[model samples]
Target: MRLQDLSAALSDLESNHRLRRRATLASPQGVDIVVDGQSYLSFASNDYLGLADHPALALALQQGVERWGAGSGASHLLTGHSEAHQRAEEALARFVGREAALLFGSGYAANLAVITSLVGRGDAVFADKLNHASLNDGCLLSRADFQRFRHNDMAHLEQLLAASAARTKLIAVDAVYSMDGDEAPLPALLALAERYDAWLYVDDAHGFGVLGGGRGAAAEHGLASERLIYMATLGKAAGLAGAFVAGEGLLTDWLVNRARTYIFSTAQPPALAAAVETSLRLIEEGDERRARLAQLAARCRERLDGTRFAGGASRTPIQPFIIGEDAHAIRLADSLRRQGYWVPAIRPPTVPENGARLRISLSASHEPAQLDALLDLMLQASG
Candidate 1:
């Protein structure tokens, strides 16, 4: 509890090779970043659309600041929620084909709001083994009878659902597995949920603004609004910040009333909400950007023809190259950094042990020459 004890714990983290370092980016987030004063090609960012440093977003932010000033100063139910927030929420609901939506300060907050609002002490929550940490934390906070099925295994989920004795059952999953870059068997999962008479909640943080013409995984699978409660973030492919939950009006209203995260946290800045609105517009209209990113991802996959890396099959922008061990993955990341590439090593706790990997995320702004150069480096490294 003391400073020295905290220092000792921090020292232990370094000794165990788990000390996290923050990278300072002098330039805006994009295909490249100026980290520690040196520019490097980036594969670590979630900016799949390459719109973070875009002119439109910049202009929108500037104009938004001029109109809305700075922070929201209080929680949504207080004096914080503005017209901009309402408009952004509405746009997101329409985009995801849901009846209504509610915004949260971040993706973590959105997950907390959804899970806690839906599941409780007597309720059961069945989740994927590999879902994001936010979802895991949400389950814990909800005080639900939390159970995890095998990753993407519907049979296991069904068995768990059949055995559950709770009054309400909630099936929680991610549309895209964050580290593995694989999609959930959404259609099968939805069908199973319906059969078991369970509510399905999907966190489409990675899928939204990247799949189904930027509508998300549920949309990609042609799953309707009634099939699931969806959550999406603006920080990923949308190139913005904050998150939202989209579903039936009653569910959203329930979240507004029951979700502690939404009730307690300070509302996001009105200017940021305005910026998110601009990002949504770009996402809805930028079909060519999405198409080009798909082509780029396919090309990159093709270039990795004969490598030891076992990246799972994913059509999304996130591509993982497994490195087996944490130390080796860190070393490879160091080597890549030395070579002016900015791909970071995904290590244990964030992922399972021996699942350390290089998460190569693509962007529409990546040039052909950059891809060729990266491929050449990968080939040399593989050899």
Candidate 2:
């Protein structure tokens, strides 16, 4: 009976065109790759700076393994923390202009640790409607009085803040919204946080290593505040695994002592930390890569002009092309895949209902010809 129920649910998902399928990648991440035994020019990766397969990063990772072996061997509080971890934390904090930073194995864990540890039942967490799923999960797990404002509606957020009587208030938002490829107004949100005496949490997963000269969105906005808790993932533009949360010294200490995800989970392999240290240097000096990425993004958007997909508002590498219906989105994805392009259709739950889209992720490694070709195919399919 239980199996039948589960199967029925899966069938519902399939019939509604909301079921997800994973394609096996038989090659390293980059612009061109093999998925499901077929080669494709992919616009589906988060490797924005084109460093995922770089020789320099590979060398650092190999060197780190030689020095630290493969694993940390225990949770951080016990014997897991190592010199490699310490050095990476220091470098991350310094790069993001914070006093300290704490590393986590993934962005979801980092968000969970920060949200759950910082607020509780009596506290209130204000969030944007379009925040990432990890953030939403954290808010729910925290048991905090969670309230969400309309997407980018500053006035609504302010209203919620003013009305909350909870002594501890937190405003959590994605610096750059993933599915929509839109950025939250950080400066404006910070002002509200200051006025309301609340903590402002900025999750810059999509902005770090690509925005603000590779210092991230806060640096992009020239924002530095004790009230701001900044978190970013290394897996996206950083072209590595894991995530980090940077802020005041006390926050790091508190998380070290209290964050359940940190306390209970084994530390990420120390070798990854050494690689991240190298990634930091590369990201800091990656002006040319960022410039190329910008040019590519601009060109992609410019080419979409005067089409049904015109006015692609994102200035970032993530450009979402809305397709309205689920089946149509799947068809478009199939069409692109058949044309040797690997753009996936983002459907319900990952996006709003009737807001299915092809999440066209761009990379600096992508040649202009590849992008132009993909865009032309997309326009043809849409037409």
Candidate 3:
């Protein structure tokens, strides 16, 4: 496209209230941050366990830098993989109860690697309609006979799986829906995968380090199986960088050999992996933090139950108050910002059309007074 055409397209996005902008954070990931020279009580981070700024993790990173330097300097197939990376991979495998695990640059890269490496032109891939964009992109890039069932509709998923005649079938879903804050019915999905003899791939990016006593949705639901491929990001609740895909030994080996993204991309910094090791230890023992987070979530839900900004049935920290119009959601977010709160306005294509919302991501680091104050602000703004 021409430069003028690109500018016109940008103008169209702005006119439709869909133009996205980046926020400059002048502080670390925490409940309080300085953004664009203004301080705010932020509720827009994915640091659910509040380990993003933990001292222990910081110390671990420093130790790692002293030992392994800052960067991996190459891809895993080359000299990039370090002892730190290997330890993290082994730790992740144990945490998720998988036979083997492989690290990737990010959750997106891991999903792309899994979907593309496992299935090809003659195979079939079934996905949830509300799966993350990365999952959808993986399906499309795989060149498989891709099919999307309705969101969380197991009956539809079963129907699709039963009707498919491909030599290989893969069912991909998110353990927890990012935007809606609801969980996938893993038991039912696993049964369907078994009945149809297909692989079940789950992206637990939002569930890991926050669910199942910090083991993630698979452990929370007791849905582990040989056919399950579990992928989780470390950047969210683990408060670190990168992602890992865990599965049986053969599958993990296949991904390491065939997944182009993993093969070609530079390995993540060894210092980050060392820090992630500390984060994992914290997550495993963070019962008090999780309990506090649950209390805070319940309080927020109860306070907003009868309000216009009520959220869905989410037991997780990701509570989203749906606002139908883009402008209205933006206005509410702006109002919250003006009041020193930093809940973000989530709009399409991040969400579906008419599903714009205020994505309130809670953290264990958030104080009770902050939650109460946010509830009060929400009521006032909605009114």
Candidate 4:
């Protein structure tokens, strides 16, 4: 009976062209990669600054292992928290201009810890419709009155905020929308949070090491307030693993005491923390990489202009070519793959119905000729 049910569900997904498949990577993450023994010019990674395989980061990881070993052997409140972890947290807080910071194993864990710790049965969580899955999951896990406003629509957010009577209200948003590559209106959201007496949570997973000169989206908009709780993942542009939450001293202390994910999960390896510290330094000094990424993204947009493929108004490294139907997007992706590209088809429930797209993620390591070749291939595939 269980096998029958599972088969039925899988059949439904396959019929809809939404059955997800994982690719096997045999090479380091970069513009060029070997997937399942085949080399491809890839645009499917979130390594925006192309630091994932940096020699400095690898060296730091090596030194960290030599100094601290592999595992933490416990949770943060237990015996897991190491000097390297503390130092990384301090560096993250300072980098984001926050009073304090707490590290988590991943961005999902950090979001769960923050939303669940701060809001509960009597409180509320107001989020954007296009927020990352983790944010929505955190809201559901909190058992809070979860309300979703239209994507980047301030009026809808304000309307929801005005209607909510919960004593504690939290506004959660992505600093940069992961799929669309557009940014949230931080200033307006901050203003609304202040007016409504809500806590504003900014998840800077895609923005931290790539935006605001490496400070992030909130910093880009000059938004620094006690009511703001900031989260950033290091695995992307940082070229390391883990995430951190930054906020006021009191708030971080509260999370340290109350966030179950942080209190229960085994602490991340101390060596990773050491590597993240080095990654932070590299990100701060990675202006040239950022510029290269911007140039690549601009070139992509310029070429795609006046084409049916152009989808969103994103100035960032993420460029989506909307194909509307799932099958069409999948076919386009397969066509590109056949021609030695590795762009993936993003389908629902990753996106809304009829909103399947090719998520063209740009990295600084991508060359001009490669970008031009990709443009030609995309045009040919679409044609």
Task: Output the number of the lDDT-best candidate.
Answer: 2
Q: Give per-model TM-scores.
A: 0.96, 0.98, 0.98, 0.98
Per-model C-alpha RMSD: 1.5, 1.0, 1.1, 1.1
Candidate 3's C-alpha runs over 4 A off are 308-311
Candidate 1's residue-wise lDDT over 51-130, tens digit each? 88889998998888899888888999999999989998898898888999999889999988888888899999999999
Clashes of each: 0, 0, 0, 0
Q: Model 3, 343-363: lDDT tens per residue? A: 989999999999999888889
The per-residue C-alpha lDDT of model 1 at residue 344 equals 92
lDDT of 2: 0.93
* Pairs of residues at least 3 apart in sequence or in different chains that clash in candidate 3: none
Measure candidate 2: CA RMSD: 1.0
Prediction 2 TM-score vs. true: 0.98
lDDT over C-alpha atoms for residue 75 of model 3: 96
Sorting all predicted structures by lDDT, with the top scorer first, yields 2, 4, 3, 1
Name the regions of candidate 4 deviating beyond 4 angstroms.
311-313
Query: Lowest lDDT 10-mer window, candidate 1?
Result: 305-314
lDDT by residue for model 4 (324-366), tens: 8999999999988988999999999888889898888988899
lDDT agreement of model 3 with the native: 0.91
